[model samples]
Target: MPSDNVYPSSNGPSQVDDTIPIAQGQRTLFEFGSFDHSKIPLEPEEWPVIIIGSSMVGMTLGVLLGYHGIKSVSFDRHPSTAIHPRAALFLLRSVEIFRQLGLEDELRSESASNFDLDAGMIIVEKLVGGKVLASMQESDPAEVAKASPSRRLWLTQNMFEPLLRKRAKEFGAAQEFSETVVHYEELSDGVLVVVQNVQSKSYRKVKTKYLVSCDGNRSATRRKEGIEWQGPGVLGESISINFKADLTPYLGTRAKHGVTYISNPAIDAGFRLESGGKAGFMIVTRAGDKKSFSPDSVSERDAKRYFKEASGIEDDIDIKVDSISYWSVAAFNAERFMSANGRVFIAGDAAHVMPPTGGMGGNTGIQDVHNLAWKLAYVLREKASAALLRTYDAERRPVAGLLMRQAYSRLQKRVFRTVPDEPELPDIVCEIGYRYPSAAAAHIQNPNGDQYEDPHAPLVLPGSRLPHVLLSRDGSQISTLDLIKTNFVLLTTGQSSPWIEAAKGMTLEIDSYSINTDTGTVRDSEGTFSHICRISEGEAILVRPDGFIAWRGEWRKDGHRDELQKALERTLYLSGSKQL
Candidate 1:
């Protein structure tokens, strides 16, 4: 446990004067505060983890860690909300994570529902000619729904961040606003971070076991570490405009034209994002050529001009400009995700960046946090060796690289050429196909076939998230995901005989769920018979705290007890009487 007062001592050279005032006029009201370095007792502080950046990746990491009882701190340089909305689509896997954090309802209530639409397509054309040149259709929504109940939610960054931040704060995460990282040094044991208050002319240094950088494409931490981003620099430039208006009258006749590619000889190419009866729409056009458009440069009048020209409408249309942003599409992967020093790690855009053609940015970042958080908790709690930390890089880097490639491929197909008959859109990669192949995963055999298999495939084997299976228990159909709470769940078939009796003397760390082998009857907490599992003779599977299979075998086998003990030992990192 760390004492609250253990602030960083003024280190070597004074690159920044402590008296310099940070610009706070641009910050929110809640962002005004000085660093509280009061020395407080370190009474087993929740997993002390520090995340830099407060966007989706940062907020997701904070909430997830907090849910697992890990104390987290997140910092962002921005005074208020981000002016530019980057990502707008949240994939199914992300929705599932939200469900785990008890935030699914809030997200569903706030964001636009997936409705019946499964996958969407991107269209490209010259804005002036209003001619469609190409289109890349995504996977069908009905097919995706049949595979899993989860669906992608469409919402802008503006609507999503506030909700996530609220949930994270509710779960005991300390979020510092208008605080920017000035400098960070990786000590042998932990990382020391120095942050400056934007309003007050004060600075504070925080020491934590691990530091995760969720900062965007221009990551200060990555720069400080001198890790170069390798790949194309500026692939293309795009101008995005968000406005509130009613374009339903014009679009109702051509709803199938969800994406209209305006190709005209006079203007640049562009596309439209329509939703909720055109309550709001985002129009994007390539930069340069005869048209002038930049997030910073484009004005309200300019936006109206482009919208009218693209939609071919002459009537006076009321448009409220919410925001305008300029983005440069590029494909880049960090030279490395984990530091050779091992105390600092990069995630989200900091690790890999891609074009928004596929909306893989936020989804991949959330997955990055998912991979890192649990491993950090395990290692910090001493349930696993520090070696587990290396797996973070091994697992996420490849996934990031693959996603970036997929995004680039989508970009190429959408821009330079037409959508092929069998367009290879890496939707699954963005959905759920990522897996960790480190020593931690080595315990289980790769049951899902190869790494390149469709990511949307159901997880049913060891090392994979248990697939959600429908089960009828107590006259109600339940999802397998609902069965596992925030603890290790041991599911067994048949009677709770000697096997259950033999495990009774141990600590109450495991929860048992038994089902009758013959009738598929489930024994709940109240000991009532409810049909859940198949209940076919033999032993059942034991799932780890993180939802991976620990062991499975017949209950009466001689080594069954030994296997259970081994599984417990490995999962909990317990040695003899000493528990990590």
Candidate 2:
């Protein structure tokens, strides 16, 4: 347990004065490398939401908020998207959110480069002529199809963050790189964020209705807010060498695969690497007590030597170092995800930390913002009450806690060999088991006491994702997920349930769609929706913008219109009779 003084006296590490701040108007790249500072504002940014990181999670928040016309700005101390091999794997849940922004196809194209290589992890005897120890499958296509239309993509943060950044900007969000949030405060009404240009050492104040801290594990915002994380801290440190080499000699026909793990007792450390196509491999191994891999300290020779020794290569291979990084593995969950008044919130590693073994650190963070973004948008747009915002923590913390433990457990299984190496949690369970319990969700039947239930179970009880079902929308085939938008969706059957009438008096963006109604209803070509979601003719399913089931109308309910209206009112926290 972290002591009370762990955070009571420290607001995280402060930016030590760079021996010298970049001189004003000087035309050289700053100490942190290069960033397009042209778009950075000289004046303070005033937006509805201020995100203090341009990480994948932060960018997703910006994109989601922008799509909803809720202006937001993101700032990062780093010059640009991760140059190092940080978080790479993205789950279908993250893909679904990107799909909403119309970037899913583009993302799929990027990951198509080495799909087979990404099939699973391979434990080898060595990088060169190594014996295969084990092969782990990340997901089973058949089981995955039953839960979600989207599947996990093997794309690194370096390759995909820019796509999100571009899409975010397209959706009207602004970004500032090399700008760090040094301080922040939640006032009676809004949050005031203080950001500084690392190069110029100049600061500006941003005042916004909300402040979302998507910064990493050592989050300054979280620390300043006195939000302490709970869980075993800092598992250990590792060296990640982003080096380019012709591994064709070693992997040969299997070069197209993404991940390769080498184990050799002769070598002091083993290699866990993911391929970066022509770019290179992001290799990780235990770091020395006093030495770490860094662009500044690691020379080409050093990187190649480290790679050769860890990979058990007898001869020095021709390798070029790109950018080396050292990172600590930790599993931590914040004491609380939100401040008392809810003016400030934390997401991503700022809220929780996870080991890289599960490839869920970044994916989980993306989902976090996706979950919070809409609720914040609705509250800001006046579609939902302020109380709805409280669900952000109530919903995400449980999942975060579970994922933290799971990631740590995976690391022990893979690295330390202290735990059973049976298999990681089933893909469906890790990706979709989490359910929200709050005013925003109304489980009308078979409510489970657990925060997360087995996703592989054949049920779409309220609060879970409306199971992916094939439906025909007009002439095109689409999944049940495609029907969900940035607002509430009331799904019913061919009878054109009363939900359509009930939404008439509502101010919310609630649209009614029936499975097989002749009056402009989407046809359930396969009857999958009815069978999987357990909905027959008279039943109704109300889905939130995030695609979680908000309410379920019992099959025999004679008058569901009023029930739906009341349920909507309760779920959305509407003060009056007005509802969807």
Whole-model lDDT values for every prediction: 0.61, 0.70
Tens-place lDDT per residue, model 1, 1-580, is 1111111222211111101011362312222124344442333332278889887889888877877677889887666544444476787777777776777777876664522233355353432233445555556776664444566776667778887776677887778878876666678888766777767846777788899998777666776667888765556555666666766665542343334455454344444454444544454444335432322355567666777766665669787766555555778888888788898999998888876666787788888887777778767766666877786786678768777777777666665455532345467545665544523543655664444444345444445555444555777755555565555566665564444543544453566666542444442332322222223345656665455555554546555555566666654445656431
How do the residues 1-580 of candidate 2 rate in per-residue lDDT, one tens digit apiece?
A: 1111111112121111111111272323222222344444545556899888887888888988888779999988777775445566777788887777788899988777644434567667666677777777666778777677887887777788877776777888899988877666678888766678878998776689999988766665666667777887766555565666666566664454446666556332443344433345545554334322322344455556667755666766676665545466667898888888888899988898877777788888988888898899988977778888888888898888877887878777766667643345665677777776644686343455655667656457676877778888767888888888887898877565665666665666687887763546488787566777788777788888888888877765456556767887788788655544
What lDDT score goes with residue 197 in model 1?
79
Question: By TM-score, how accurate is candidate 2?
Answer: 0.86
Model 1 quality (TM-score): 0.79
**RMSD (Cα, Å) of candidate 1?**
8.8
What TM-score fits each model? Answer: 0.79, 0.86
Instruction: Show pairs that collide, candidate 2.
Output: 117-257, 117-258
RMSD of each candidate relative to the true structure: 8.8, 7.7
Off by over 4 Å in 1: 1-47, 113-119, 122-142, 253-274, 279-295, 418-426, 443-449, 455-459, 473-475, 491-508, 511-556, 565-580
Residue 499 of model 1, lDDT score: 49
